[model samples]
Target chain A: MSRPALAVSALRPRTAPGWRTGLLDSLDAVGAVVLSPVELVGMAVVLLGRMAEFMLLAPFARDRFAFQRLIFARDLGDLLFGPALRVLAICVVLGIAVALVIEQFATGLLSQTGTANLVIVTSLQQIPPFVASGVLAARGALPLAVRLAEMVDRGQIDSMAIMGVDLVMLHAVPRALAVSLASVVHAVLAMVVFGVTTVLSLAGLGLVSTGTFLTALKLLPVYEKISLIGLQLLTASILVVAVALVEGIQGHGEERVDLARVSMVCILKAATVVLLVNLSFALSRMPDLPVLVWR
Target chain B: MRPAAPVDEAAANGLSVEVRGLVVRRGRRRVLDGVSLQLAAGAFLRITGPAGCGKSTLLQTLAGVLDADQGSIRLGGRPAATALAAGQVAAVFQRDSLLPELTVLENLLLPLIAGQHLSRRLAMLRAQVLLAQFGLVDIMHAWPARLSDALRRRALLARVMAVQPQLLLLDDILAGLDSAGRALIGRLLSPPDGRVASIIATSSRVDDFAHEAELLLTLPEGRISPSEPGQEGSGCDTRP
Candidate 1:
């Protein structure tokens, strides 16, 4: 009736035993992690490079910044907050598991393989996809979900059908593609971070130095892995987003449809896409790197 | 008192709508159970019923918003489903469905733009004329939220008219209007010479509409009782 007073009132107290408050707290924690020195530096460097690229091209610089400003305002939250929040959650959980495993196996596993560092790096590789998916889910999925909710409430989606707008193209496909791009960025960022951090840390420790890690990074397997991950993330994002958008639009036909239902569909879609990507990546591991890349 | 005819006279052509066993379900409740009716061209049918009696649902189903469980509805000799699929119907609801943030002109522009016929210039000219005709020229730029309930209703009606619909489905457009305002809108809706076929769901039976209407289909519950000849002075049955 009166906009159902979103959990803002109950969120006043820190101790409020509500999901809304909990979500806020989790978001705040994510903000802290993303703003940490290393991430901030990475983000700033990326932003500066983009600006420099704009500046160097005298003809296109102004137009580029104008476009960037429009896109940045539109995508800031999904780009910055979505993935950062996702990374925070993943880092916390995975960080705990990795710590536990290291404590348990300690000297034995590390000493035996002489590749324990590789294992750690490989495990951390998941961060990018996680961030990308979060961005996709947030940027793309949130708006679609919100639109569906509004459609259900106001009956506009029904009106759309009455007017003969193609339900899928008019709303769904663009929504999916828009969200998927965010996921792609997230995954690429994660890969870059992984590559750079491994090189820097290995050099700092003097265990393998910068050139050694850089050489390892150049190995065919690493490129193959990153590329394959990109392909997989793209594929998965498109699929999940398509499904979620379709479902959200279809929900309007019902006598009554709720946001909870749309959200469940979103979660299910994200999970299915992630699993498919993981499976694809595992399968791609056996293929020859060059062949896979070209094909 | 017949008005002078327009040169085009296209707006005066009427369209017929037919429903065959139209059944609608809102959860367990079957709002319109095996409902069947036929509205001829150049005619007005006033649907009257008690509150919560599926009067609005029936109109909505015709408007293509609600899906019928079992049956078919046709508009202008084609399936209502096909007609809507082909983009050929417009409606005005009991509740003010105007976009509150937008001005009266913007609200009217939505249907025209959506229908993809009139250009911006043509739409502006038509909107201005409609506003002036409806006496809404004073507040054409005012947001719907700022207008009074009656004014908002009038603005929405004006917008509905702007689309030049063949089948105009109105849901209680005259519900909250004062006598003078209601008479004016009813007159505009039913210009003696103009022939826009319509189905208006209303609680009150206005005296002015009595002469113009061809049929009166009364509904006590969800079912249409019987179509009787239009009678004068049998208006404003205000009993709740």
Candidate 2:
């Protein structure tokens, strides 16, 4: 007797041409790499828009905004105080290390004014925001992602949705705002610590007098200080938190392995976003990089 | 104290459910296939099947948590999603549904304040009353991690009940409870004043819900098996 057609087909080997398969794989990789940022940006826009709506409507819709206040307070307190000591330690160490390196390398190579200027600029305008982003990502964003992933895995998010709770309003907005506010606070703290440590180290090393350091600080324009704060705020509030919220909400899986993977991907993506944002800002400020700006 | 009336008292008074040719596929497997059922307002249904027989899937579908691949589900003459958005549907899953971060009292207050837009003072009052009703008054400030399995289940039910859902979908709520725990929760499930208009509960064993379920039917292989001629509360048609 002849074998059944189904069994015959099941026994048949299936293979795609090697060249075609390779081409398709390459295309898929390219598509993922190109489309991921676009998708992330779209989601971040929608999330931020919803948060703005809730905030703007709070006065007229106090009842609706009441529950979110509790969430905001809780998250804000956690984000601000949870990593305060770590951030402080990092800032103090970073400031002292940078100061010592500048004193050693630039003592005779550059004038005292130039060395002090470098110290002020690097401490206040650069480095601290990047370090703050790293700290917040590790301490704040990753944990937020893990917590949200757990909620997704456990079906608590679905349960909340079924109960008529807007997940964005209830969870995302508060967290994004908290992280943004906390990032600003941490960045400010870092800048202050770096300024203090650098000044103290330079004075102790005799590379620059306290008078010279104060003069360098006075030479730094008010606009520069404002711009630095603005840069930190924009990076943390928009980019870092957005990455965390998107990855946390969308990257959950049904297994513990999936949770770990999601956490890893969230941190990596957050770090990439922070770096790209700071790099863009740095490029825009460079006088030689006229191509980055349109007059 | 009596439970507070639902936000939409008119809609909550009665929520009739009609599900037709419902299909839910999980990957390659059809979890719910061509299942159909009709439930009148104020009725109780017990869906019994072996483990992995789509009981929870049906509940999730009915709660609007899962999308139906094919077919229709209507609650109170509206689509399931609409009814759910109106705060007319509540569900308790086999898994722990309580937010671990919130206290028992805060958990109860969540749906009220966030979902129903009730004032904090009113939500607090309603939450306290529900806690007292569920015998959870003593542990009102306790977190879900601190509660026993039975208490967690009770607290979950209490939180869902906070919104006074018109249709209650319960999946294996009595699974981990002892006999006394089961009995106490069973009494709570069928409140006297009829705050909940309808309930669809699922269990693996038929006898687990024998006392409270008004209609009992079996689901085998993603389809509802017809009730035997002499089965109790078999008046409702659940054939697929």
TM-score for all models, in order of appearance: 0.61, 0.84
True-vs-predicted CA distance for residue B180, candidate 1, Å: 11
Task: List, residue by residue over A106-186, the lDDT tens digit for candidate 1.
Answer: 546443333444544554455556556654664565566656555545454444334332222334433444455566666
Question: Which tens-of-lDDT digit does each residue in B20-74 have in candidate 2?
Answer: 7788766556667666677767667787887877787788788766677788988
Residue range A122-212, candidate 2, lDDT tens digits:
4476666777777777776787777776766666666676776655346777777777778888888887887888778877887777676
iRMSD of prediction 2: 17.1
Leading candidate by DockQ:
2
Provide the overall lDDT of each model, using Cα atoms, as 2-decimal numbers: 0.56, 0.70
For all candidates, what are the clash counts? 0, 0
Docking category of candidate 1: incorrect
Model 2, residue A72: what's the lDDT?
80
Candidate 2 is graded, for docking, as: acceptable
